[model samples]
Target: MFTPILAISASLNDSQRIHALKVGANDFINKPFIEAELAARIKNMLLTQQLYQQIAMQKEALEKMAMTDQLTGLYNRHFLMPYVEKALSSAQRYNYPLSIVMIDLDKFKLINDDLGHDAGDKLLCGIAHILENNCRSEDAAIRLGGDEFLVVLPHCSLEQAKFKTETLRQAITELPPASHKTSASFGLSSTEEGNFIFEQLFSMADSAAYQAKMNGGNDICH
Candidate 1:
């Protein structure tokens, strides 16, 4: 819990100090903090702070396990939900549209069965890159594991979401497929009314994505 307080800014306001406290920071001092005084404050906070760097690091590690895919750096299913909800709320509050696009790598099993798992993993990572590159700052991308990926786009309409999905569809298609052909199916849903129903919102879009897969791969269905 011990953290050295070097006043991050000379002009820091009371609100900034309060912000530091909320993050478990201790000992607020005005900037131009003498090295000695800062050291003393750190020493004082060390015992009380419970040496939190360890705790902080462990907390982050646990969060990574919870929120991220173990094999890929992409986020997990549970982590995708909140961002989607928050985006929906923001859109509703401001009378904007929020959309989500779900992408699933098609014929993934054949790659593993024929080429083996290593190549499959590389393809997954590649998809992660393509999906991430396609998103804007307000969008979030997550890997729901086992070749499933989802994106939450804030302040976006169905048209915009479809465009983003199509971009990813193209990116994935251009990537050299593994020994067997690789492809993706996309489904998109947007909040037409203000309040977005959680489960069914995704269900419709997810179903659409499956339909795309059934028809053929590398296509997006809204």
Candidate 2:
């Protein structure tokens, strides 16, 4: 909400009116102003403020849409780089641990082929919900396109990350029968002091995830 400013003056002059506007006045009225005119000015100022607020809200909504995945209602790849950069900077400055977990649904295409794209979408949303429920409020769960997802855990050690991923893996395995026996492979990377670059860390996690898939999906590798 915005506060409307109405500048009232005894002796109105061009210089005084300009000064009032410069000082954040929405409208200026002389001492002997008519009550109807003052009321009209107040009404206009309120309407203008309402319009400004609406514009700000709309801009915020658009920005959120740009960074969110429409399918799963999770953060999309567009939000990943900036978030990683900021989290990494904070981790380095504070000398804390940060972890990244890469998740890929096992045999996802088979599900799509067998059940249909709608079923595939349902499973993805289900998995995203599980991820959201399992993570801390400060953590980020992201959909990195297709059947791939990533979790960012700030202030988490490598061992802790592995434990969490294992729990999540089990959760996916135990999903409702409607999910058609879903499973996933998890690859984890962590830095205790934020010494590694984002690319390096992400590559390590991705390779680990690939290895997990190779070892027979539904596994975790770090």
Candidate 3:
């Protein structure tokens, strides 16, 4: 992708020189050129190329920072909608199951109230790591604001989602004790028909998660 091409050619018309530059010629040298001038042109081109590459890398890093959650290093809620919409459209068109798991930390407020926000933040970050480590590479682990997270599992069924949630729940329980013990509740929802919209999918998962919280603090509902 990064080919450093320096084209040395004989004399060219104005239009031809413009075309060469447009098509990515690093430097074009005319015949009977002075050695010093040619060397200077090549050096300038190399410096320009380096500047361009560094600017490109900086731009890429800035974009990634914008899309990521600073606390957990996971994709933030802002990045989830567009990605989920695209995935849902594909699953619906192909008739494949797509599941969304909604998770909430149990008694998260109590931890903040008792210990401090720093402790609560650490617990949230720990939970984010568990979610990231447990899910497949293709899945998206998203932090949906404080204490709430969502995992989008493409081509996964309700049963599979249940299994995954259980695994995560167990992992949360096993974390070393902090200021306060941490547990999580999960709600799993899947698309069966081809017409379920993204909002409906979210609603199903959100409702289930609320039910899990009502029943107890650490459980899963679907």
Candidate 4:
């Protein structure tokens, strides 16, 4: 609801009042009405508008909380699948490539063990900031729980994804070093076909990420 609407007219017939009410009039005033009454109604309408704006802002904040990671302030796993599906559908419909990149911190457990959980969290948040800065407005950065992250690139090719992940890898290396040092591995997969399955793309990326880790981390595999 927005500002409360008012109907000011000389008509006082029952039908006229009913019509006003049905048309969403919150208050009605007749011609030659008392100035005090008009002023009071105006004040009430202004108050109602303020309340409506407050409620709208609260609702927006709640929705953002539901979709975002509390620690990194990035999109959480809950937002990934749905958002990817929508982006993928649009990409497929338009015959454009869509890519997914899987990222995992290398030797992350050592950070928590040697330093502290708080330090580990700080590192993650720092990396999240890099991702947010590197990605375009059309891209999404997701915290897929723990030290795992995902990046969805709409209308981006596999090669483009590789370049982006390489950039991110370089950025990660610039983060303050942990006692055991900090690094990450990346994997990418892309499709231009409308019939491609989301799970298949994700699995490909995951496997490639695993390969990168096995090959001694700090690199991208596709």
Output the number of the TM-score-best candidate.
2
Off by over 4 Å in 2: 176-179
TM-score per candidate, chains pooled: 0.76, 0.95, 0.90, 0.95
Better of 1 and 3 by TM-score: 3
Candidate with the larger lDDT of 2 and 3: 2
- The order by descending TM-score is 2, 4, 3, 1
Q: Write the per-residue lDDT of candidate 1 for residues 47-85, one digit (tens) a residue.
A: 555657778889989987998887777788878777767
- Write model 3 residue lDDT over 127-191, tens digit each, in one string: 88898898888799999998999999998998998998899999998764554667888888889
lDDT of 2 by residue, 82-123 (tens): 999999899888889999999999999998999889888988
Model 3: how far residue 108 lies from native, Å: 0.5
RMSD of 3: 2.1
Ranking by lDDT: 2, 4, 3, 1
Candidate number that wins on lDDT, 1 or 3 = 3
- Model 1 gets an lDDT of 0.79
**Model 1 per-residue lDDT at 121:** 92
Best by lDDT: 2
Worst 10 residues of 1 by lDDT: 1-10
Q: After superposition, how far is residue 136 of candidate 2 from its true place, in Å?
A: 0.8
